[model samples]
Every structure is written in structure tokens, then in C-alpha cells.
Target: MPNAEKLRSAARLQYKRAVLWSHARRGDLVCRLMLHEHLADPYPLYEGIRAEGPVYRSRAGVQAVTAHELCGQVLRDSAFGRRNEDAGTAEPAADGPPAAADAPAGGGNASFLDGEVADHMRWRRLVAPAFRTRKIAEYRHRTEEVAHRLLDAALDRGGDFDLVTDFASPLPITVISELLGITDVDVDRFAHYGLVTGRAIDGVRSVRQATEFREAAGELDAMFTALVRRRRDEPGDDLVSDLLRPQGDERLPEQEIIGTCQLLLTAGFETTTNLVSNAVLRLLSDREQWEALVADPKLAPAVAEESLRYDPPVQYSIRVVRDTLHLGGVTLPSGTVLMLVLGAANRDPDVFPDPHRFDITRPDAGQHLAFLSGAHYCVGAPLARMEADVALSVLAERLPELRRAGRLRRRPTAALRGLLNLPVSSGR
Candidate 1:
């Protein structure tokens, strides 16, 4: 970017941070979430926002909804949509660097997840087949194998191991890499990419972080571009090849294909990694739950669902009012941005009784909106669930004696809730 443009961007970021900090200091729960200090435990603040009623308007003007019903309604309502170019709400700078200047040719760095209804549906349709039930089943065995292999290595190392680094992180990375036909796998680099991009969701905290995000994004894009080109020449049994397949009349543009690959790699890797780590952390924290899972590994799926509901990897989502509408006793004008606190919604007492309690046996655990709802629901949900299930089941069977080896370290991001380091031991 030109010096002038960079200066403007930096100024906008500084101004936004100042406003958020001001509101945070003035006790705006929503704004407080943006502060690093609250990263470790934002649930209390979520409850604080809930105390202000279902729809809590922050001093910053963004409305937050913690009610499960309201969050679900907004997610399913066509009147509320993803942010567009003209939307009044600016993308949080901390969320990541601006896409416009850094975006590659074609459609730039815009995600189809953020596109308008028609375009979003079009892209979703094109890629939905890869993550369908049948495809996920096909990948299940591979996921199980990878999970066991990871645990085997961890066990061989003996003593204590950082679960996040040793198993949780790499399992999904390997699975997603194979799914994408990335043969020259660099596990550490990909994990770094996942970390950089995942944290980007919360926005860049400083000029240094912004620079790292840009570099990671650029590297990821270049890597996918090369993969797409290679797959086009020598198609294989992988997602990229499947996307590159000739779809008579409907075909994704080359840029969209690359973007989709990048999305799948980071989202798929990060979400599953966090899900496994969070589930294990909670289970081990409550020995009864851990013992139950160890006693009956079949409960792994339930464990996964409960983990998603109790402590989802993704904590929140943002939507813009596409049309004037009355919601939660408040009338929101078009262009108004609303924050849907998914974590808080999942723990809504009305939806999940004893909401804060981590119970794997909660029958309605599947009702949570962790994967969101409506058109923008995560397409990778099936794969994530399968990976988590396999991961937890394998760990339970092999390391039933597993226990925390050290204090957990959380990723310093509000939008995404995950552990940076989860140390564990076989406890034999």
C-alpha cells in the first residue's frame, strides 16, 4: 500500500482502538471483550451484557444479543446479513489487516461467507459436496488413524506433552492437509498459519501483529495458488481437485477456488484443534466427566457436542441489519451492526438448563449455535465433529490416565476461544 493509504489505515486503527478502550473503561461489556485482559474469561462479561437484557446496546453503538432465541432468530433472518462494502460497521482492525489493498487479483480477499445471499449460496453449493455426510464418513477412518498416530508419538515422548502442540493441533492440520492434497506438508508452518489467521479473527492488536497477519495471509494465498495450479494439471482425490472438477455451467473462479482452499485449511485446522483441546481441558478439570468418557469411549460424540455447546471454539459472530427490524424490544435501523454472542447464547439457561455446567450427557447439546445457523452455517461442521469425535475417542482409549501437566495458556483473542498451549501427561 502507498504511504498515504498506510497512514490513513493506521490512523483509523488507532482511532478505533481508542474508542473501544474508552468504552471498555466506561464499563461497556461488549467493548471490554475487545481488551486483552478479558480474553481469558469473557463469559462473566457475556453475563453482564445479558444482565442489560437480551439486546444490550454498547456505547460504541453496536447491539449485542445473548439470548439463544434472539441470536438464532437473527442468524436465520434474511433481514440481517453479513457485512458488505457499504455497511456502516467497519471490519475490526484487530480482526485482521484490510483486505482491499492486500487482496490478490479477481475478487480480492473477500470471503464468500461474507458475500451477499445469492453469491454466498452459489459458492456454498459448489463446495458443499466435499463436506457432505458421505464424504465425512470416508474421512473418518483417516482421522482416527491420524489421531492415534499423534497419541502414539506423544506417548513415546513420555513424561509430559503439550497436547495442543503434540496432538490437538497437528491432528486437524494433517487431516486437512491430506484432504486438500497438500503432499509437501510442513506441519509447523501450517500450525503457525492457523495461529496467525485464527487470531486475526479478533483483529490485529498492533502494527507488528498486522504485519505478521499480512505475511501469513500472503504466504497462505501463494501456497494455495500453487496448489490450485498443480491440481488443475494433475487432478487427484482431494477437495481442491473436487472443486476444480468441471461443473458444466457452474464453476468457481480461480481466485475463489484458492480462497476456498485457504479458508478450509485455516478454519478446519483451527476449529477442530480448539474443540479437542477445550473438551479435554473441561473433561479433565472435572474428573467425573473424564472418567465417564474413559469408561465409555462411545460417549466421545456426546463429549464433542457438549464441548461445542459449553465452550465453543468460535465465541461470537457479527451481522449487519439489511432491513429495518424490531428485535429484542428494540428497533434497529438498516446498516446497524449486531454482535451475536454465540458462547453466551449456547449457555442460555432457557436453552440449556444448568448452562454453565459441562455435562456431556446434555440431550440438547446439539441445539447450540456454535456452527451458527441459516445460510451461513459452517459447511465444515461434519468434518470438525468427526475429527473431534475420533480425537477424543482415541485419546480416551489410549490414555485414560491423561491429566493436565501444567497451567493452560489461552490464545489472546476474543473472537476465537482456544488454548495456545495445553500441557498433558499420561499419568501412568
Candidate 2:
């Protein structure tokens, strides 16, 4: 970017940071979530917001919904949509440029998740075939194989390992890499990309962070651009090549293809990484739960669902009101930005009895909105679930005595929750 544009971005970032800090100091729960101090355990803050009622009108000028029913309603409602690309104003309390809503540093909507209805459906149709049921079944066997291989390597390295780095992180990364036909995969670099992009979800907190995020995003975009060009010349059996294939003269733009690749790579593994680590963390924390899973690895699917409810990878999502609508006893005008607290809604007492308890046997666990609901519901949900199931089951069956070997360190981002380091040992 030009020096003038860089300076403007820095100024805007600082201004947003100041505004966020001020609101957080004034006890705006929504704004407070943006603070690093709250990243460790935002669930308590979520509960506080819930105490205010299902709908919380934050002092920061954004509304948050904590009720399971209400959050699901808003997600499925046609009146609520992604922030229009042409919309001039940013979401209130946005610490930096909107990460998920607007185009990222490299420009263009990075995924169908942020596109308008027509565009979203168009992109979805083109990409949906890759994630169809038949395709997912084919991927499941490979996912299981990858999980076991990761465990084998971790176990061979001695009893001790960092689960996030040694096992949980690489399983899905490898799978996604192969799916994308990335011949020379760089696990460390891709992990770094995931960290940077995930942190961007909460928006940039500093000029330094903003710079780092842009650099990472640019690098990711460049890689995909080259991959797209290569695939066009020598098409292969991969999602990119599949997309490059024409459908009766209908073709995705080159930039959009690059964006789709970026989206798939980043979104594909990040959530599963967290889901696997989070499930293992919770299960190991409670000896009974761990024993239960170890006894019957088939319960791995249940563990995955409960973990999603107990500690979702994505804690919240934002939507813009497209028309005046009354919800949760409040009349919200058009242009109102809504923060759907998926983490909080999953634990709503009215929906999940004894909401705070994490039980693998919870019959209603699958009802959680972890993947969200309606049009914006995660398209890769099946893949994530299958990957997590295989991961947790393999770990339990192979390392039944796995135990925490060191302190847990969480990723310092509120919007996307996961572990940075999960140290563990095969307690032989």
C-alpha cells in the first residue's frame, strides 16, 4: 500500500483501539471482549451479558444476543445479512478493518461467508460439490489415517509432546493440503498463517499486528494466485482444478478462485484443530470423561459435539440488520449491527439443562450453534466433525494414559478461540 494509505490505516486502527478501550472501561461487555485480558475466559463475560437479558444493547452501540432461540432466529432470518461490501460504516467496536465481513488486505471478499446473497449462493454452488456427502465419506478414511499417523510420530518422539503442534494442528493441515493438491506443504508456515488470520478475526489491535496480519494475508494470497495459475496450465484432481473447470461457460474469476483457495485453506483446518484440542483438554481435565471415552472410542462423535458446545472455536459472529425488525422484545432499526454470541447461546440454561456442565452424553449437544445456523452455517461442518471424531478417538485408543505435561496456553484472540500450546504426555 502507499505510504498515505498506510498512515490512514494506522490512524484508523489507533482510533478504534481507543474507542474500544473506553467502552470496555465503561463496562461494555461486548467491547470488553476485545481486550486481551478477557481472552483467557470470555465465557464468564458471556454469562454476565446473558444476565442482562437475552438481548444486550451494549454501551458500544452494538446489540448482542445470548438466547439460543434468538441467536438461531437471527442467523436464519433473511432480514439479517452480511455487512454489504459497499456499506460505508464499520461495525461498532470493530478494532480494525472488518476481518470477516469486508475484503481482507489482499482485497475482494475472501470467502462466500462475506458475500451478498446472490454472490454467496453462486460461490456456494461452485464449491459445494467438493464438500458433498460422498466426498466427505472419501475424506473420512484419509482423515482417520492422518490422525493415527500423527499420533505415531508424536508417540515415537517420546512420551511427551505438544498436542497442538505435534498432533492436533497437523492432522487437518495435512488433509487439507492434500485435498488442495499442495505438493510441497509447509506445516509451520501454514500454521503461522492460521494464527495470523485467526487473530485478524478479532480485528487488529495495533499497527504492528495490523502490519503482520496484512503481510500474512498478502503472502497467502500470493501463494494461491501462483497455485491458481499453475493449476490452470496443468489441471489436476484437486478443488482448485475442479473450480477451474468450466460449467457451460460459467467460470469463477481468477481473483475469486484465489480467495476461495485462501478461505478453504484457512477455514478448513483452523476449526478442526481447535475442536480436537479443546475436546482433549476438556476430557482430560475430567478423569471420568476421559475414562468414558477411552472405554468406548465410538463415543468420539459425542465428545466432538459436546466440545463444540462447551468451548466453540468461533465464539461470536456479526450480522447487519437489513430491515427494521423486532426481536427479543427490542425493536432494532435497519443498519443495526448484531453480535450473535454463539458461545453464550450454546450454554443457555433454557436450552441446555445445567448449561455449564460438559457432558459427552448430553443428548442435545448436537443442537448447539457452533457451526451456526441457516445460510451462513459452516459449509465444512461435516469435514470438521469427522476430523475431530477421528482425532479424539485415535488419541484415546492409542494414548489412553495421555496427561497434561505442561501449562496450557490459549491463542490470544477472542473471536476465534483455540490453544496455542497443549502440552501432553503418553502416561505409560
Candidate 3:
């Protein structure tokens, strides 16, 4: 009885629903990657996406959610699980053994990100001490010293250079590698590993495109196996030693320790790397702020906080649903993946005044969720802070005539947006 027009409408409706439920396409790597950089500058895109609908299960079927309050709600809610999900999940506790079904296959790449919730929680408990406030404070002087040395050498060179390469990206890697008792291999190689890993695992990888991931994951696992054994045999006075030499039966199992080391290396190294790069890009864009920092190094700490707010390191993190959730203006179905675009949320005008403006002097600048909210917060937050403070102070003091040479280019990774190469010149 239906006419051709009605038949076409029905077909369109069916297609729409089909896109929302299919996971086969969700595993596609190349085509889905077109959305990578767009998600990097996600606010404007998110605004348009939000207008269409709060939650849109993509053609790939991985649900993407982008709103301020909604992000907070999802992240804070425990029911929005990250274990055994359609999209992906994180290892249960950093230091606990892998879950029953999610055990390391030994041969294949392990799904370290997806495991039982309790194991994830246990992992979180074991690694808590190393990232605690006091521990980070102890590392501050050293982080600053490294930053000062890098910038001072750049100033001594007295020529055009890339901010990201010369200083931002490498500094945090050096600091973290030393802290984790990882020496022998070149720091620069690990820096490359950090960048590649951050780019791959942080949803920047095409779910289908995991070849690079296989290589990186394998090398990392092999590297960690050796490191873990080394720690057990001859522990040092650093984080690895702490994890290896935990109090009493508080020790982590071998597989759990491997996963934890991988997480810590990635988290501690990459997060601060992006943080430093993001801050420098913000500074280069805002010449006045750059000049101000050059005038007073004291502004370093506050400016670093503002950078975390203005352009955070980790852009979007995902949470899996265990219960139906209502947030912002949309209700998410149980078991769906909710993508929390922190960069977009940080710019939410509801929470921050003139959220778009990169104002270091802004009083409420520190309130941003750059370090995240609640229990799953960043453990290396203080170390990141110290690293930035030292680096910024050194840049201001040493590079008096630090000025841009070319347009800043951001990295391709959606989850961590920072300069790939920020060109600048200083007076010789």
C-alpha cells in the first residue's frame, strides 16, 4: 500500500538505526580516522554535534558524547563502566592480576585496557602511593632542574628552533624515565614511544588500524618484562622500586606489574609532555602572556594551571555504561560508551567565565578538570605541575627574545592535543 516516497523514508529510518547498532564498522581504521584532528579542536564540532543530538551512535557505532555537565556526570558515575565494553576498557587496578576472561593471551596483544572492574580498582590502589602529593613534591626540584637545563641549552644555541622538539616534548620524558629507573635505552627513543603510544591507544588509533599498535605493544611488553625482573632483583630508590618493594603482601603480581609499568610510563611520560607543549602553544599564541612570563617567573605556576584548563593534555576519555544515565540533556542507554571531551568541557561557559579566553590571571582558572575529577584522577598531577613550573620559569628567564618563526602545528592525536612543532627564534 506504501508509495515510493514512503518506501524511501522507511529505508532511511532503517539505515539510521542500523548505523547505531553495528560494531563491525566500528572496527574500521582508515575511514574513521578522518574524524581524528576534528575531535582535537572539538568544541565547535561538539556544539554542532550536540545540536543534532546529545548522543549519536556513529556510523561506526561507537557512541560519542560531548557536553560539560554530562561529561562530569558520566565520569563521576561508577555505573558508566570501563570494563568489557563494546568500545574498550582499562585494566582493573594498576597492580592487580588480569581478570579471568581478560587474561593475557601471551601470544596476541593483551587488552590491558579492558578487564574486571574490581581488578582495575585494585590496580588503582597499589599505584596510588607513587603519585601521591608528597612523592610528587619530592620530585619537583629535579623536574625543574631538567627543564632549566633543556631551555638553557636552547638559549645557548641562539637560533631558530622548534619549541616542541627543543624543549616541551622531551623534558617530561627525561624526568619520568629517570624516575621510573628506566635507563640504558636512549631517552629520545622512549619519547618517540611515548608519542606513538599516546597517539595509538588514546582512541586516535583506528580500531581496525592496530598494526603500529601491535609493534609498539609488543616492544613495550618485552621492555616491561625485563624492567620488572630488574626491579625485583635490584630495586632502586625510585617508582619501580616502590612498586616492586611494596609493604608486606601488598606486592603486585607479575602480569599486573607489567600492566602497571606500562600504564605508569605512558601516563607519567605522555601527560606531562602534552601539558608542556599545550602551554607553550598557548603562550606563543598569546604574545602578551608570553612577555609577562618573561617578566616574572612567579607566573609560571599559575600559568601552568591555566594551561591545564585552557588546553588540557588528554582531550577526551571514555566511560562505559552499566546503568542508564541522564546527563546534560540526553539519556544514555546502559552498556553504551560515553566520550567525555574534556577540552570541550573545560571551555563550557557554564562552569568557566569566558571559557574560550586563555587568561592566566583568571582567578578560577585552576578549577578545570585537566587532571580529571573524583577517584580516577591523575596520580602524576603534582609531578606534571612541577615539570611545567620549572620549564616555564626557565623559558621566561633564559629566552628573553623568544618569538615565533612560523605557525604552530598541533599533533594528530585527538586525545592529546599539543604542538608537534612550534617554531621560534631567540636573539643570538
Candidate 4:
């Protein structure tokens, strides 16, 4: 019986893929996004979708929003929300056609993608304090220290090294591990889990990937569960301990604490890793941009902001309509999903003149919604910015002659835009 069910699910998924591919071949802009050939460069598709109109209805029954204003408005509107397991919105990937049966659902209690509203707000509130202004400020010095230390090791290795592995990736892993008060670090193990889980953001493509995600989630849950228990008895000065701290007379539920730690652990490192790598890749791609940063490494923050606007790590976000809302000159029924194409929105010509050009000094680069806006704005935006600022500045100052050593490779996932390997030399 179980085998029959599995076979049926796989068949359904395949059928959905066939439908998407058929529509894509017939010139469906949204369906084209799910194709591998287009994932590496999706801007053209975004522009196509935008050209059609602000709101495009995919053959898959979801709507896509590519305009900056419309995407921002949908994200900020209280009537729209993330579809979590609690809401049964996790049935499939609403961003495009249905994914594999085991594909993870939209954010909810699972990991903050699309969960129940009350639960989402409560979790956000409980975790918000740890990422408050003062708290993030406190981590800045340590972030710089980590960036410097990682660069020192990369330099010592000599010849060409992968920027993604040697520098960009490890820096955030070390920092987040410490912040979570995780002792006895397992860099290789945790990094693997983070990669698998991060790619799940794009939706699991196969049974093997689904299985791996389950194992990774289980391991992380076990680790955090133990940590929470330990913090309860002997708390430390870390985010985990702080979260476990009681609220007045009652303590946060176990699931909420676990969910908060999971969110911090995954989002804290994954997004920042891409930010640093994407920034460096963009700088190196254009010699003048690279030279400009080398000329004034102090402009690292500006470079970071520009990278977020030019080529953000996160390409798009999804929102499910909760009510019959009128937007983009169209009426969307309740339960409609909008794939807010953030990357395209960032490059919207109306909002950003000369949108395709990457200029670090663009005064309004900070206006981009790379970190999103409104109630679900990324809580780790501050930490990510600080980390990238320090990382970029340190790299420019230390290796002013940095240049690409080999062909760059981007991650296979479409939702998260980042380098899988960026081989570079110090020009030594």
C-alpha cells in the first residue's frame, strides 16, 4: 500500500512537470523559470513576465509579480501571507508548477518560510530581540575578526583557492555557530546540512533530495533540542540562551525555541555566504568596479548594498493571497500565490534608472527590497550587511589584485543565487 502511494505521488509530480514543460515550450514566462537552462540567467524571463503586465497568471494557476512597486505592495500588504503547513498551502511549490511530492511546504512553523500568522508573529517577536540594533552592533567586531582570520588562512594557502569554500562560506558558518553558542563545531557536517537545506528553498527535485532534507532537519533538531535543554539548566550569553530565557513568568514553548534557533542557524549563514560571494563575483567581473573598491576599501558597505540591488542572493519571494485583493490592475482571488520576483523588481527601470548597470555609488541602492519589506522583512538583514561589509573591505585591502583564476559556477537552485565555486588568485 505504501509503495503504491509513493508511486502515485511520483507519477503526479511527473505529470505536473510535463504540463509545465509543455507550457514553457509554448512561451509561458513563469514556466520557463523552472527550466534548468534558464535558471542561470532568469532576468530575461522576469522582464518578459513584467512586459506582459504587472501581474501574470501562470498556466500552473499562480500569479507572478515582477514590477517593483507591485511586488513591494504585495509583500507589505497584510491581506497576503506565507502559506505554511498549518494552512495546507505547502501542497506544492506555488512559485511555479508543482514540485516533487516531498518538496517542503511554504513557510510556517517548519522554518519561517510560510507558517501560520499568529505563530509566525510570536516566533518573530521571540527571536527579534536577539537581532536588535544593539545586539547586532555587539557582533560587528567579532564579524570583522572572523573575516580577517578567514582571509589570513586563504592567503597562506597560496596559489588559487575557491573564494566560496575558503573565505565566503566559512566566515558565516563560524560566526553563526558561535552566536548560537554551539560548542565543538563540526564545520564539514554543518556546512553540508546547510547546503542541502538551503537548496530546499528552491523545492526538492527528487526523492533522494527529500530524504536528505529529512535527515538534515532531524540532525539539526536533535542538536538544538539538546542545546536548549542545556541552556535551560546552565544558560550562556548566546542567542540560544537568550531565547530560552523566560518571558515574565512563563517560558517560550519548546517548538518555538527550536524553530527560532533553526531559522537563525540556516538563514544567518546561507544568505550572507551568497552576499559576500555575489559581491566579490560582481566586483571581479567588472575591472573598474574592482579597482574602485581597491581604491577605497572603505566603500565596502556601498559595494554590499549595490550587490544586493544588482544581483541579490535571494532572487524572489512567494506570497499567498488571503483575501480577494485588487492589485496591479487585476483582481486576484483568495488563495492565489504571487511569486514576487525580487531580482527583477530590484532592476525595475521605473524605480531604478539604468537598472542593469552595477554602480557601487548609486545613492539609492539602499532602497532595493533585497532584504524584503514589511512584517516579514528578514530579521538578519543587519547581521548580513555587517558581515558582508567587513568581508568585502578586508578582501579589497588585503588582496587588491584579486582576480578570477578559473570559470565561476553558480548554485543549481534557482531561488538562491550564489556561486558554487569561485576560483580566484591574489595576483601574487
Candidate 5:
């Protein structure tokens, strides 16, 4: 999604017919919106999708799930599979996941990095314990420390620098790094791999642009192989070590464990980074909201909540149907792809009154689907919220005069929404 307009214009559209032999295409059956259309804001699109009905059958077997009622059903209900998790990277081309072979030129967000649905219940089980509600509380102090350290560096330098590189990217990386006990060597290695991973799997980026991404994935696998070996011998007080520890009778494979850790680091870092940056971007543009948070620190959390609803870091997600399920007037057969418009749905008026308003005090702010729903909902949702809440509180408290330095640059990721670089003036 780095160059959205370019990617949109360049991608060759492949239309699929419902009956294969028939002219009835999925795109023709439902309201289809290009990935770019939802860029920046997608509420109007969501409203339109919602009006179409609960179950919208589009061309190419795509079922557009818009309303909170249906979205929640698809996510929470047991009828759907997470889509990509179980299927691996090789497929008959649905929502283009990172292909099995990362094209030699691939370097941007792969097709469906975050949307891979694998063992929703088991996947959740393996990771939920680490990021559970109770455990997330313990990371606050560390999150605050990391946020302060990054903010201090940015504030003290007193010069123009990208908030993402200078702030957002580092903030969450540092926290997760320390949590995973990754330092020095592992840090840089993960940083590079993280960027590659971000662009390759991010729904926003293109498939061919992720050449470096596949290379990084290979390197990451090798690195984790070494790390897991070390952790097995000498366990550390970090996540990787815990994941490697024996789990009764369900011992995790080194690769799967690596994938799990890599997934966490990639997902955990960018999202929180995006959350911090996106919230900062929204606040910087709205003078009143910025001033409100600076005045009343309690409003910081509210600001984070509202930002998730307003300009969420991660946008839409895709789900695959397991069996023929009836929704609205349509009955989608198994393998029907459902594109969940998370960002658009958050702004749906039917769900939230004055959907366009970014009111921090709005009670509906918490009701947004930014973290998603059901078993596959983001495992680190609580941790992400806590991290942002703490980071924003610290940033507002420390650099009270922070203001946008220039036109903030957005990270081209449509899925992970936020600023790639937000130049801001602070400490004066």
C-alpha cells in the first residue's frame, strides 16, 4: 500500500464467475470497493454495503460483510474458517496471500499477512495466555518506559524526523523486544524482518513488491531456529522461551513456533506503532482534540479508543466460509470469501450516532471493531490498547507543546493504517 494509487492502477483484476461456466461473477453480485476506496475513510462505503443487506454476494465468491450484526456473526459464529491460517500460502488465488514463492520483485505488503486463519481456537490458546487481560497489565511499566525513552529522544533532539521511524516503530518494537528478551543482534535482525513482513502480508501492499520480504522471512526462520535452540537449553524470561517450553503433550514445532513468534513481533509491533502514530496524526490535525488530551490526561485513553474507531491502524480483514451458510437473502457456499470492512464498519452510522464525529467522549467509541471480534480477534488487543494509552499519556505529559511539523506522511499500508512518518515539533 506504499504507493496506493500506483498499486491500484497496476494490479490486474481477475474476475471470477459464481457458476464457473456462467457469466455470473462474484464482483457483479455484490457491491465491490477497491482496496484503495477505503483508504483514509470508508464509512460511506460501509453504509452502502450495509444497505445491500446482511449477506452480500459479490463476484469472485466474495461476500461483503458490512453491518456489525453480520460481521460479528461471521467473526464470532463457528461457521467460518479464518481463511489463510490452515491453507498455507499456496492457493487458487482468492485474496492474494503472500504467494508460496515471494516473486523475485516482491517487497511490499503481501496479500493476506494478518488474515491467515489457522486453528482459531488453538492458535488463540497458544497465544492468549501470553497476551491475556491479566498478563497485559504487567507490561504497562515496560510499555511506559519504552514509550518515554522514544519520546524523550524525539523531544530532546528537537528536529524533524518521522514519528514512525523516530517514534511509533521504535516504541512497540522496544517493548516487544524487551518482552521477548530480544536485544542487540536480535533487535536489528527483527527490525529488518519486521518491515519486510509488514509489507508482504499487509493487505495494503502489492504481491510483487515483497521480494525482500521473502528473503527476510527466510532469515527470520533461520534466526528463530537458532534462538529457539538456545532458549531450549537456557530458558529466558521472555515470550520466545515460554513458547518453546513444553505444553503438557502439545509441543510446538520450531517453525510453527518461529512463525508464531515472528507473527507476534510483526503484528504486535506494527499495530501498536500504527495505533500510536495514527492517534497522533488524528490528534495533530484536530487542534481541539490535541488540546483536550494535553489538558486532561484521563482523556488520553478515550482519545486512543476514539482513534481506533476514527482512523484505525489496521483496516479490513477477510474470512472464508466453511459451509453453506444463510445470511440475509443469500446463501454463500463453502469457500466464499467474506471481506470484513473493519474500518468502514467502525464509522457505520447505524452502529454509531454521528459516525463521522471523532468525539473522545462518545460512548460508542469502545464499540468499534478495530480489534475485531470472535476467536480470531487480535490476541494482543488488550496489550495494544494499554500500550497506546500509556504511550499517549506519556507523550502528552512530556511534550505538552507537540504539534505537527509538516504534512504527515501515511504508511501506505491499507490494513495497518497509520503514518509512515509524522514530523512533529515538540519540547517548545
Candidate 6:
């Protein structure tokens, strides 16, 4: 059965790839987006897509929208939903890769993102308490402490350090581990799992990757299942424990709890790691921005917001039409998938003036759709923002002379834009 599933997955991927190639040959903006060269700087390609007007029909049989107003309307409309119109035909979301949207239990991270509307709300209600404004504020001090400690170690190591691996990565891993009451988890092993699963944001491109994703999912389930059992036996003052608290009829299913844990672990660190790395890369590239930040470390929050607007961590989000609807001056039938290019929308000149400029002082940068919009907005937005604000502030204060020490290696994924290795000097 597993072999059969793998074969089916392979066949689906090949068909998609072939479609992309065919449309790319005809200069279809949407299909050409999947090309490797566009990964480095896709903004120009987005501009081209936008030039075709608000709605673009690709030979691949889907419509894409890059205009800010249309993208916002599409996202805010209840007629569009996260699930594929045809459940049997799994399609990757626009902003992310092939997620386990409706995989069965013990299959993949059973995140609320994959759940149906009601199930999503139930699961979201269970986890939303941990990310509330007050709860997020409570996490700020620990975030700062973690950031400072990681920087300390990086600086103590002398010359140069890979910020992504050493600092950006570990800080979030530690924070999320503590938040989830996971005491025995291996940080590096979890990081590996995140990378393997994170690649799915770009869809499963190969059979080997699909196999690796399944393995990673199984391993995470096993770990989270063990933790769930342990917490059931002896609960503590943590998110998982709070979740396991006796709620009578409100308690979540055991598998749901495990799935939420897996999702948190997978998503909790990966996006934030990219956000920090991307922000630092941009800041250093514009020496004035970096200097301004160093001179007034209070600008860290602004820097974080602008980074999200200028170069968001998640570039696009896909929505499937649930009913026949007119959008962006085009009529799309039910079952049609619409790709919302968030990175493009954020820089839409109609909304944000001089969209490409990375100005930390951009007053309304917080208006970007980087976290998405409407129903599927990121629940971790507050936590992520808090983490980045602290990370940037601490880096500026502690390493004012920080400079690039080596090459920046970007992760090879289109949906999730982030750095794999960013070497930098501590200027000690």
C-alpha cells in the first residue's frame, strides 16, 4: 500500500512538472515561477505577472492574482477556502509546498491548517490561548534571554559564525521546546525534521523527498505521542499540559493534541529562523539601514515589520474556489485554484509606495499580508514578531560592528524563502 501511494505521489508530481514546463515554454508567468532561476529574485517575475493585469490564466489550468486589492478580496472572501475543491486531487497551497492537508492520523503533522473548517476552529481554539496578547507578552523576557545567550556564545567563539545555525535556529527551538514542555527533545534532530518537512512548502518534487517527508512525519508523531502520554500521566504548567487539562467535553482528541505538537515544532522555528536571517541580510546589504538600526536599537520592531512587508517569509498562499465566482476581472469556476502572491501583494505599488524600498521607517509596513489574511492568518504571528524584534535588537546592541564574514546560502525552496547559512562577524 505504501509503495502504491509513493507511486501515485510520483505520478502526480511528474504531471505537475510537465505542465509547468509546457507553460514555461510559452512564457506563462505563473508556470515560469517554478523555474529555479526565479527563486533568487522573484520580484521581477512577479512584476511581469502583475503586468498581465490582476488576473492571469496559465496553461497549467489555474488563475494567479498579484494585485494587492484583488488578492486581499480573494483572501477575505468566504467563497474561497483552504481545502482542494476536489479532495482526491491534492494540490500544494500557493504560499507553501505540498502540505499534508488531509492526511490521516499518524500520517503527517495533523495541523489545523489541514483540518476542515469546524475541525480547524476546534483545534485553533485549543491552541489559541497560548498565543494571546498577554501570553505573548509573558514570553518576551524569555525570548530576550535566549537571544542574548545565543549571541554570547556566537561572540565567544571568536571570528565568524553562521547565524542561522548557531543563533537564529537555536533560540526559537529552545523557546518552543520550553513552551511545549518538551524536556527531552533533541534540538538538532528537530531542526533536521523541520528542514525535511519545510521543503514540502514547495511541494514534493521527488520520490526520495516524499519518502523522507513520511519518515520525518512518523518520527515526529512517535516523539509527540510519547510526550502526550507522559503529560497525561503527570501534567505541568505548559501549553501541552494546559491543553491536556481536564476540560470535560472540551478536551481535544489524543491524536489532535499530538498533531498540534508536531505542527508547532515544525513551523515554530523554521519561519522565524528565515525572518531573522532575511532581515539581517537586508539590513547589512543597506549599510545605512544597519547603521540606523545599530544607532537606535529601538527600531528593531520596525525593522521586523518592514522585513515582513519587503521580503516576507512565506511568499504566496493558494486558495481553491468553492463556488463559481468573478475575481480580479475574471470568472473562475468552482474547483479552480487561485495562487495569491503575497510577496508581490506586499510590494504592490498601488498599496505600498515605492514597494521595493526596504525602509525600516516605512510607517505602514505592518499592513503587509505576510502572515496572510482573513481565516487562515498565521496564529503564530505574535510569537514570531516578538522573537524577531528581540533577536534584531540584541544583535544590534551586542554586535554593532557585525558584518558579513562569508557567503549567504539560501534554502532551495520557493514557498518558504529563508537562509540556510549566513556567516557573520561578531566584531568583538
* Residue-level lDDT tens digits of model 5 in 96-172: 32222121112222222333344445545656787886778888887877777776677667655567787777777
Number of the predicted model whose lDDT against the real structure is largest: 2
- Model 5: worst 10 consecutive residues (lDDT sum): 100-109
Model 1, which residues run further than 4 Å from truth?
1-12, 87-107
TM-score on alpha carbons, each prediction: 0.94, 0.94, 0.82, 0.93, 0.83, 0.93
Candidate 5 residue runs with Cα over 4 Å from true position: 1-38, 84-87, 90-118, 185-192, 202-208
Comparing 3 with 4 on TM-score, the higher-scoring candidate is 4
Q: What is the lDDT of residue 80 in candidate 6?
A: 82
- Where does model 4 exceed 4 Å of error? 1-6, 84-86, 89-113
Question: Relative to the unseen true structure, what is the C-alpha lDDT of residue 240 in candidate 6, on a scale of 0 to 100?
Answer: 86
Native-to-model Cα distance after best TM-score fit, residue 11 in candidate 4, in Å: 2.6
Which residue pairs collide, candidate 2? none
Model 4 quality (TM-score): 0.93
lDDT of 4 by residue, 1-428 (tens): 27777676567657767887898899887777866557667888788888898899888666888888988887787888665234453223422432321233212235444454675676677677877889889998898898888778887888578899988888888888999999987777876876786677665555566567667877888888899899889999998888787767656677667766776777788889999999999899899989999999899999999999999988877777887879989998887777888999999999998999999999989989899888788888988988898899989998998999999888877777888889999988
Model 3, span 277-327: residue lDDT tens: 778777877889999898998999999989888888876666667877665
Q: How many clashes in each structure?
A: 3, 0, 12, 5, 29, 8
Better candidate number, 2 or 4, judged by lDDT: 2
Residues 262-303, candidate 2, lDDT per residue (tens digit)? 888888999999999999999889999999999999999999
Angstrom error at residue 265, model 1: 0.6
For candidate 5, the TM-score is 0.83
Off by over 4 Å in 6: 1-15, 88-106, 246-248
Q: Each candidate's lDDT (Cα)?
A: 0.82, 0.83, 0.65, 0.78, 0.65, 0.80
The worst-scoring run of ten residues by lDDT in candidate 6 lies at: 94-103
